[model samples]
Target: MSKSEYNTEDFVLDPEFRKWVLTNDPEAKRYWEEFLSTNKSKIQEVEKARKILIHLSQERFALPDSEIDLQWNMINDKIDHMEGLKRQTKVVSLDSWSAIQHHKEQSRQKRKRNFIRTAVFAFSALGCFIFAVWFQSQKFDDTQEVELSYETMEVPAGVKSNYLLPDGTEVTLNSQSKITFEKNFSGDIREIELVGEGFFDVAEDSLRPFIVKTQQVSTQALGTAFNIKAYPEEPISVSLIRGSVLVTNSEVSDFKEKLVPGEEMFATLDNSTWIKGQFDLKQALAWMNKTLIFDKTPFITTVHSLEKWFGVTFTFENDIPKNLFVTGEFKDESLKNILDGMSYSSRFSYTIDGKKVNLKFKP
Candidate 1:
């Protein structure tokens, strides 16, 4: 049949039409769009076929060929029986019997043609549905083979790493930090699980929200830049830079808060309470710029940061100093330099042993 004479069944069976429905090919899309604009009368059939294709794409199961054939046979038998009943119910009067018989024969032929057309259309639709099911089943099987495929990046103590995600999001991983995500990010959401600290400059995608999940909290953003610090023993904090984000306690689904630029959200792993306030951008992003800032940082906290930054282990010879606070800024400085600068004011002595550092009070 000519393209213009094609009906719903013909459209459904057309390979080109199916391609337009199932793929993102620009040429196919353009052709179909133009065709539909010009063939307004066939719009209904095109839409129906499109919907069937979409339904097939989302289906995860397929009917077996044997089952499909069985169903088709049952439907065909039922249609045949209905046609036979129409044939048996006919009665003709003796008066004008010839005329009546001719009329009845013509009517029967018309009905037969109509029935065949209807049956063909119905069968074609069923066949498309089955094809969709089988296609989805194969796709599901393919996905199952790669569902465990993931990419992981980790930065050891005393070092950092920078990476770009497939979606164009930039990430700066801090010392002893790790991020795990799907290899292809083939999902409705772009999600990454984080351990330790990382700064993310996410690409904007309204349809796919970027989520950073930590042990304590989860932060979600769309086209925003933010930093998350979630050390194993410390409180998790999210610092927003240029865009907005939503932070929520992982343990408490109802506990969610939105953060604006310059705002930081803090939540401890042990507690459900969340705190938010303005954060110092320079201090939060100091590591990314190779700068370390200690504004009255505690001795223990300082030790933790130093260990990660320098890839070393710290051993305390005596009890940790009480009420001790240190403040300093080192930009691209050596580990020894930072320690020497802090020891002068903290009155501590440290000896380095390969990757280990021992600290004690100087008499």
Candidate 2:
């Protein structure tokens, strides 16, 4: 039969359909998606078949093919034995058999009908037995403990990394950032633990919420783009680029705030108080696009930004200048150029040793 006419049984028994439901094959995914889109009327049947296939894939090892065949054979043997008894019951003495041959023939026909009915019942029983076994196997699987594994990705200082999650969410990790998540998110929720800084373009799935947890706060999104910066010993900042997200204290659930586009929420690690304010898109995403913008930033804060940007460490020999501010916009500029430009105004000298930089007050 053509695919358009295929019934639930046909789909369940199809090898290709089973493969698509069980494995990660791009072609199979496309084919099924397209098919379902065009044949919306068949969605119920398709879903039923898909669920059965997925269940079978999980419990396939519970019952071997050989064992299933042995059970069928045992059922059939019992049916055959009953049929033999029916045949023996139809026998009669020779004198009575001739005298009531017509009645005897009717009785024989009745016996045949009884045998057929018994065979059908036996087959139906067999089906019920198989279904029961599958149901019990599923129950056993549900109760069994599952050990979850995790995967981690880290971006060192002076570098950035981009990753695509299994659910098609896009993430860009900033310098000295790390994210850890389950290797296979086969659960109801999609969750990630993040440290440092990262930007996310989350895919929308109302059924499963995407969550990013930091040391101080947690950001939850349902199909939104946002940036989060939560470095140790610094205030946690969450910026929303598009869509909306809920920011909540990791320890205190009641301390929550909602963020909209072009808005930022900040929370300190020590205090759970949340502060929301307007944020500059250019300043927030400069690092992602390989640009640096220091808009009236303090001299010491600038030093920290440079270290993270260039993957270097900074040390001060003398106390940093009080009330010193620096402002600049650099697109793909070298660390030396940035420091040189800043020094022309800040009037401080700096020396570089491998990955370390030292600043001292000039006499």
Candidate 3:
């Protein structure tokens, strides 16, 4: 039969469909996405099949091809038997019995009908028992745990993005950030590795704590909203907006600190000690609102932020002023406008050509 006519069972049995559901194959993903797009009605069937495959795959005891075929054959045989019984019973109508001999025959037929009903009920009960046994067996077998496939998402410099995780957590990724996460949150913990900065509105899962792992630290939260800035070579910062988070230094696994609302944790990659204190939420989350807020920030740091914010490469034509600091807020401002504002105060001339900007400090 054509793929469009496939039912849930058919989809589950399909090798290509199972591969797409189990492994992270770009070709399989592209094929299935295009298939579902055209065949919209089969979406629920495909999803149901995908879930069944995922469950079976996690248990590491998926039905073998031969076993699957055998079970399906048995099911089809049972269905055919039920149809035959229905046909036989349909021919014997109540109106057909009239004479004395016929009444005797009807009495015998009634006994046969009762026997058929009992047989059908027994078969159904047996099927239910078998299903229950299989389900329970799969549920409690914890000897083997399989590793799940992971996928990575990267946002290039000068562009910010947002993504929804499998567990319904909302993530607002800042410019030049990358996040690597599991394709599905089937593990004990909903974990993700982040590079650069991201704001997480974590989904509440009491059973599975949402964890954001940076190079030097790991932040664990359950139903909390927080932000983490962990760009390479820069100090890592975890700013909690609401709820609470437990921050642990990866280098010093014994070191852990709990953070409450409005608190921020700062840890340098080069240092083992971390500091926690109150933070400015607006300043921390300014990128989310397409704004940049500088609080007497060093010129080099400000340039780094601007480079990521506008997707530009900055080159110093002359020696950068060591005393230069910028303090301002620019919301949805052009790169030229921001540069102009900064140049007026910092006494620097800059030329923007394509993606590169050259800065010359006025003497």
Clashes of each: 5, 0, 1
Q: What's the lDDT for residue 52 in model 1?
A: 45
Give one digit per residue, the lDDT tens place, for model 1 in 191-288: 99999999999976544689999986789999999999998988889999988998877678678899999999988778755788999988999999
- Alpha-carbon deviation at 5 in model 3, angstroms: 37
TM-score of 1: 0.63
> What local distance difference test score does each model get?
0.79, 0.80, 0.81
Please give the range of 10 consecutive residues that has the lowest summed lDDT in model 2. Answer: 133-142
Candidate rank order under TM-score: 2, 3, 1
Tens-place lDDT digits, model 3, residues 156-250: 99899999876668999999999998778655678899999999999765546899999979999999999999999999999999899999876
- What lDDT tens digits, residue by residue, belong to model 2 across residues 295-343? 8999888888898889999998888878999899999999888888988
Candidate 2 wrong stretches, greater than 4 Å:
1-137, 140-145
How many clashes would you count in candidate 3?
1
- Looking at model 3, residue 16 earns an lDDT score of 90
lDDT leader: 3
Candidate 3 segments exceeding 4 Å error: 1-53, 57-140
Better of 1 and 2 by TM-score: 2
Q: Number of clashing pairs, model 2?
A: 0
Q: What's the TM-score of every candidate structure?
A: 0.63, 0.68, 0.67
Stretch of 10 with least lDDT, candidate 1: 139-148
